[model samples]
Target: MTNDFRILLKEDMRNDETGERWFQDIEIGSVFFFSVQASTLHDSTPPALLDDVMAYEAFQVTLQIRHGVYNFGKRGAWQHLEDKPWWPLFEAESPVLTVAANLPVATVQQVYEDLVACEKAHPEMTTKKCLRSLSVC
Candidate 1:
């Protein structure tokens, strides 16, 4: 790998599910930071501190995304994204996404116009871009 990969997207493990909580589709040269943490409850009562406990902290600094799968060890934990392509690494179902801030509002109208033109030029492409709230690529 030539040391260039940027994080296209990432999600933290906010709920219980095994494995690391990071994903990316970066260019050939980029740098990013991922702050990872793990915790467990102790004693099931007040004063949640105890000696028999496990704790982990790390800065997954500067991951380089080459064209193949790479697995870094996390205390023998199983990674959900193992052996999967970048897109499939995303959960099977789409998350309930809030409107992304960077998608320029005006671009929607422009894209619609382009789609219309494309359909006119090639009648086979006349499918609707919006079908049941999912954008058709």
Candidate 2:
């Protein structure tokens, strides 16, 4: 038995002006989200936390995404908040792909492959605009 998880594409949106794309995936009743945006001059957040962050000039895959939640007593039954347990599978510059924690290496590779395929199928939606720099490592 394996605890590996997979993400199914639920929605995809892009901002033509900024070249920023958002992806939402369904997994275990929650949405796994990520984005790819064009690089910019005043990027406050370093793409990768490292001594030489510039080396990762190709792109940046930030593990930062809002976690979906269901609040039974709230007016809105569901909300996406910044507090989520999904951790980065690897550093910013790593060519190796990863998702949430505790997943096997093979599972991470599979997820990366799936994402690449999706990007290839939707070339226009992948990176057409260039507003700000963001990436999927």
Candidate 3:
């Protein structure tokens, strides 16, 4: 993640510019690495420890754990509030790709291929090819 992203919560589940609650300015195909922070919502009525709470689900959210390049377009078209309730950058898909949390691979490539394709549908991606290098060590 390049730390160049923001999380916006939309009001209506459906796509309606006037009805949406929040909107994030992001490139259409750009991919982002994001994770919902575990949260605890507590209630105090009988002086109990707590009641209400929110937590991160196991595998409920998929993280590609890769870097993405920038493109042009609305972030709303690529992301939905239903899939990622806590924040933006959450997509319904499998995050393009994913790897083990233990950093199984030292480097990853084509993190931006999807975004690039979405930006401009061309055969160059498959023919010429674009690659990205990541450092795990």
Candidate 4:
């Protein structure tokens, strides 16, 4: 199975109290959501079942910039700063970022840079540690 991902929606949310948007200002607690469309192709499937073999799915990814790390909402995972390979998912030319062109590229780059700095300062934090500290685990 070959899968391709594309951004179906990109939302840069603002702070409810501060009314500050993420793209305009890189805030520590900024949040964003990306609705992705995944297309999977099954090449081994019979020609008669080609249409059924190709499947599409829509999923949402929620990310929040914490004090010194970013959190993946669904998996409750904390991503560190050194992870740059996945950044391509936000770039315009990447397969995963084909849609949502309304978002400025520079703004996305700035967010990435800000996240790197935020995570670099506190590399010890992880999803388990964070949840344990909050007594949520």
Q: TM per model?
A: 0.19, 0.25, 0.20, 0.24
Q: Which candidate number maximizes TM-score?
A: 2
lDDT of 3 by residue, 1-137 (tens): 32212122111222233321212222333233432111121111121211121111211223332333322233322332224223343334543432222110111112222333334543222112223322310
Using lDDT, give the best candidate's number: 4
Candidate 2 lDDT by residue in tens digits, 1-137: 22222223222555445534443543221222333221232122332222332232332233322222222223111122212222334343322222233333353434444534433343233222211333321
Score residue 109 of candidate 1 by CA lDDT.
25
RMSD of 4: 15.1
Q: Return whichever of 2 and 4 wins on lDDT.
A: 4
In order, the Cα lDDT scores of the candidates are 0.23, 0.30, 0.26, 0.31
Pairs that collide, model 1: 4-28, 4-29, 5-30, 6-26
Please state every model's RMSD to the true fold in angstroms.
18.6, 15.2, 15.1, 15.1
Per-residue lDDT of 123 in model 2: 28
Residue-wise C-alpha lDDT for candidate 4, range 27-50, written one tens digit per residue: 232222233211121111121111
Residue 137, candidate 3: Cα error in Å is 14
RMSD of 1: 18.6
Candidate 2 — what's its lDDT? 0.30
| TM-score, prediction 1 | 0.19
Residue 75, candidate 4: C-alpha displacement in angstroms:
18
What digit string (tens of lDDT, one per residue) describes model 1 on residues 35-84?
21122221122212222212221122222222121223331111322232
Q: Give every collision pair in model 2.
A: 18-131, 19-129, 37-134, 38-132, 38-133, 39-133
Error of 2 at 48 (Å): 20
